[model samples]
Target: MKLQNSYLADFLSLLFPQLCPACGNDLVAHEKIICTDCLYNLPQTNFHLHADNIVARQFWGKINLETAYALYYFTKGGKVQNLMHHFKYNGMQQIGNLLGNIAGSQLNKNEKFAGVDYIIPVPLHKSRLKERGYNQSACFAHGLAEKLPAVVEENNLVRTKATQTQTHRSRFARFENMQEVFVVNNPERLKDKHVLLVDDIVTTGSTLEACAIPLLNIPGLKLSIATIAYAE
Candidate 1:
């Protein structure tokens, strides 16, 4: 009976195929949100092994970061970008978990990301959270926690209010807009711990910087950053 049900499900899938969100191709029975080809062809950045990669260089004199890493390099209209679009705007939240799992597997092999005590996602404003019905960064954080030793602290940091859209702003303007936007809710849990700050995608990293500033104030707190993609 179970075998018949499995076969029936496969037949139904064939009739109503679920396409890969990133590639717009038919997903195989084993494939999830992203097909294997798109997953394998992702422009990966092996920054985890190197301490002074491009991501680390971006923060050079701006913020005091222990290290930074991005799993993939993002290009406009590319697979990573499409993946992010679906993950962020298309309500495909599972993409975050899958990508986070891949990132965690990679980071697990690197010594730099080990020993992280907390995994915190950059928070969305209450209004945005309500509108979106979820925080995509938190979804990624949960996936990372499954493979890493750190605990996901979703409420530790939060956006104080909604800020203006940053898409067309200059780098400095972006940073200014994000200034004073994030506040730490629980400083006690953050103090003296190494935290892995996460987000969906990073361009100039202004948003991550804003999230990091409050975390930086925690006594003995060390900060490391990880993002799904780095838009170069």
Candidate 2:
């Protein structure tokens, strides 16, 4: 009966074949979001191995974070951008999950991220969350936790105010605008914990640093950051 069920499932799948999210190609037997070629060809940053990488330098003189890395290099009108479009606009939450899991596997090979106690995603405001149906960054964090095998905490950070989108803002403006936007959900619970802070992409990093400031102020708390891509 189980074999019959498997055959029936295959027949139904053939009736409505799956397509890859990255290239819109036919989905392979083991594929979910991306095809093997796109997976192999996507640009990777490999920023974790070096401590003083440019991506990490964005945080310098700011929060004094423990470790920072991004998995891919984002280019305008490029494949990474296309993937992000699907991730955000196409409701391809699984694509973010795939990126996060892939990046997490790379991070898993490094010992730097092993001691993470809790994963904290840069939170979207409640109103926006209601509209979007999901926080893309949180989806990535969930996938990371699965790959890293750690527990993730949601809504531990809240966006206190809605601000203008950072895309149109200057770096300094992004910093100033985002300063009062985030507040840690519970300071007491986070104290003395090595927290892994996550986001979908790091552009000016003013947003990440803005989010990090309030969290880092918690006594004995350590901050590390990860993102799917670094806009270079």
Candidate 3:
């Protein structure tokens, strides 16, 4: 038997018609955010299996990273974008966690991401966190932690300064703006650790770089990054 919200979602589909964000088909009950057909058809990057993937290539010579992977290739107006929409604007955090679980199960078996000591999500500024009631990246990190070998440290990295949204900003503008937006509140917690940084999406790679810069200064700290989707 489906739960009340599940049934409600189904009923709402009758009124609003829950179209698959990728292909515009009706979603099956178990499909949740995206339909089964779209799930299989969604262009997965498969970057986790390879060390020299484009995601990793983006960080070369800019930041010293051990590994990087994006679960799916982001297409304009696709299901992944819809999922991100719900994550960022519609208060649909559970969907983010579910996607993280799916992505994590695949990443857990990959060799390059081995021996991660902690899962650290990119923190949201307090203003944004208050508006959303939770960080969507945290939702994803929580799910990844459920399947990964490492523990999750929610407070080790933090957004100290509230800044403008990065969406409208150019890559250079975004990266320049993010300086000092993030701060290490607890450096002692991250020393000598290989950290898996998790986030909802990777676009332009600026925000991730900002988060990585401060952590890179910490002694003996290694970093890897994972995202729900990669927008190229």
Best by TM-score: 1
| lDDT-best of 1 and 2 | 1
Residue lDDT tens for model 2, 91-149 = 88988788878988988877878778889998988888888889999999998988885
- Estimate every model's Cα lDDT from 0 to 1: 0.90, 0.86, 0.84
After superposition, candidate 1 runs with Cα above 4 Å error: none
Give all TM-scores, in the order shown. 0.97, 0.92, 0.88
By TM-score, the candidates rank as: 1, 2, 3
Better of 1 and 3 by TM-score: 1
Q: Which 10-residue window in model 1 sums to the lowest lDDT?
A: 106-115
How displaced is residue 79 in candidate 3, in Å?
2.6
Candidate 2, residue 40: how far the Cα is off, in Å: 1.5
- Lowest summed lDDT window (length 10), candidate 2: 21-30
Q: How far is each candidate from the true structure, as Cα RMSD in Å?
A: 1.1, 2.0, 3.1
- Most accurate candidate by lDDT: 1
Q: What lDDT does model 3 reach?
A: 0.84
